[model samples]
Target: MSKAIARRGIMLVLSSPSGAGKTTIASRLLEDPGIELSISHTTRPKRKGEKDGKDYHFVDRETFTRLRDQDAFLEWAVVFDNYYGTTRKPVEEALAAGRDVLFDVDWQGARKLRESAKDDVVAVFILPPSAAALEQRLRTRAEDSDDVVKRRMRGASNEIQHWEEYDYVVVNTDIDQSVASVRAILAAERLRRTRLSGLKGFVQTLLATL
Candidate 1:
């Protein structure tokens, strides 16, 4: 009879500037049942059509501050005057059960997560093929005003400066190809020896049987 080997989960962090297709790639990756999004806790007000637990765990500033003081968050950051954090308890539980978690964070948030859980984290940075391509992608959406689009383009430049900090970089010229590349990275990271806690025990059992 064959036994299953238990393994620790991966914290797959994907960071990209606006219009870089990071969210689209993450959506594709979530189709796999083995991985789930790491829903974050935020003090930002819920937007229209956003649900409490689905979009984010919306909490009051007082509660967020309390949790931060207690060290209950695996990583926390202040972005545009709003507090965002990942609670340690649920992620730790999921990892122990061999369930992977995906994080869509900015460069600062990614840095914090790495500091908190260095061993479990795999960070990827997504980029556009060129500045012109990024501007075109943002304009194609037709959802943002001209000023907003310009602001986003400027932000993208600043964000892309941190690309070298990531473990992997994918220049997203084709959506399908970018998704495939990210999927391959996830598959390879899942097989890493350090994540497989049960490998040693499985080997011992096999040796005994042999």
Candidate 2:
């Protein structure tokens, strides 16, 4: 039997505004064979469809601050004035087990994630086609009040301005097309030569046959 290659898993970070098509993309990516979603810890209220651990781990401000003090977060950020964080242990464990983690966060969290795991992290910024479309999408969520919608739109411009910070920027003009783009990026990253741990031995074995 052939020996399997051992490689550290990729940390795929995807960030967008509250209604910037991130959840849809994130859900689709989690269905992949080698990927796991990092369920973030948040101080925000849970949405109707979200569960305690599935959507986000809802915690009080005190718990969030305590975790931060302990350096438990690989990345943490405050967006729309809500505190959110991703713990280091879960991502570390997944990579050690040869599984990748997908993170849905803002630029604030993405910056910290890159700092912690620069070698293994691939950051992607998802952008809406236009400001009008982004605003329209936020309103369609129906959970937000008009004031909240305005607030989100204001924050979105700031977020979009940081697109160059990402390794990849995907304009979400079409849902299927954008997701396909994300899929392509993941497929390529997984095949990088550095990720194939047993390459030296595999090459040596092939040379012996010659």
Candidate 3:
């Protein structure tokens, strides 16, 4: 008879500029049942087709401020005048139960998560093939107005500057290839010795049988 070995989960963070395909990659990754998305709480207005609690826990500024004051977030950040935060309770619970949590956050949020939980974090930064391609993606998506798209383009440069801070960098030239690369990273990280809580005991038992 064999015993099931317990494993601890990792915090997989995917950060990128506004049009660099991080969201797309994340969506594909979520198709796996072992990993779950870390749904964030945001003060930003929900976009068309966004469902509350599913996309984000949309709240007003007052509620967000209260939660921040209570230290309810594992990590929080302000981007483009909107507040976004990951709730501590849900993420902690998931990690403890061996369910990996995926984060689609900015550099600031990534920094905070690392600072708080360095051992469990595996940060990956995604980049666009070129500035031209980034702009074209943003325009073609049509999710934002002209002014918003311009602002995002300007912000992309600043975001890309922090690429070196991440553990891995993926240049998203092709969507399927980029996703496969990320999936590989996740697969490798899952085998890291530190995350396997039962390895020592499992090994000891196996040695006894020998």
Candidate 4:
């Protein structure tokens, strides 16, 4: 029996406006052992129940700036008043070992990753079913003030404009359905011929035997 061909892992990027349920989808995707979530380094203070290096690599602003200046990040963006960035080393190592890395970032960060690793990156944009629905979801969370919710609603239009930049778009009408769709995308991408690094050698050996 032939051995399995080794393939490079994908950099799956999930981007959505606040309250669009992208984070929820990402959390569900992380349940699979084959997929690993990229832990971003952030300047924001860690919230309750969030751990260092798990939820995020909480760092000081100066440290974050130093890393950013060193070009150590695959992508970085400023959100609200804090800086967030995905480090390059861990992601490169994971891909080399055939472990897929999932990214939960904004459209700006997604765009940066696309420019840097176009072939390895598979970006998806999640959209809420309707504007009213999105606002309602935000309000229901009760985490943000009314002023912040209003600001988010205003910025959501700009975020939606970048949906065209992503390779896939899923309207998050239902959580389970959307998660299934993303899983399907990951399964299909894994089988892509370009990603299977050992495929050429395997095929050549078979042809030689014939």
Which number leads on TM-score? Answer: 3
Poorest 10 consecutive residues of model 1 by lDDT? 1-10
> Candidate 2: how many backbone clashes?
0
Structure candidate 2, residue pairs in collision: none
Candidate with top lDDT is 3
lDDT of each: 0.91, 0.88, 0.95, 0.94
* Model 3 agreement with the true structure over 58-138: per-residue lDDT tens digits: 999999999999999989999999999999998899999999999999999999999988998999999999999999999
lDDT of 4 by residue, 1-210 (tens): 234788899999999999999999999999998889999999998877789989999999999999999999999999878899999999999999989999999998999998888999999999999999999999998888999999999989999999999999999999999999999999999999999998999999889999
Better candidate number, 1 or 3, judged by lDDT: 3
Give the per-residue lDDT digits (tens) of candidate 2, residues 48-85: 88899988999999999999999999988887678999
How much does candidate 1 score in TM-score?
0.91
Model 2 sits at a Cα RMSD from the real structure of 1.7
Which structure is stronger by lDDT: 2 or 4? 4
TM-score, per-candidate, Cα-based? 0.91, 0.95, 0.98, 0.96
Clashing pairs for model 3 are none
Model 3 segments more than 4 A misplaced: 1-3
Number of colliding residue pairs in each model: 0, 0, 0, 0
Residue 157 of model 4, lDDT score: 94
> Could you tell me the C-alpha RMSD of candidate 4 in Å?
1.5
Q: Which of 2 and 3 is ahead in TM-score?
A: 3
Report the Cα lDDT for candidate 2: 0.88
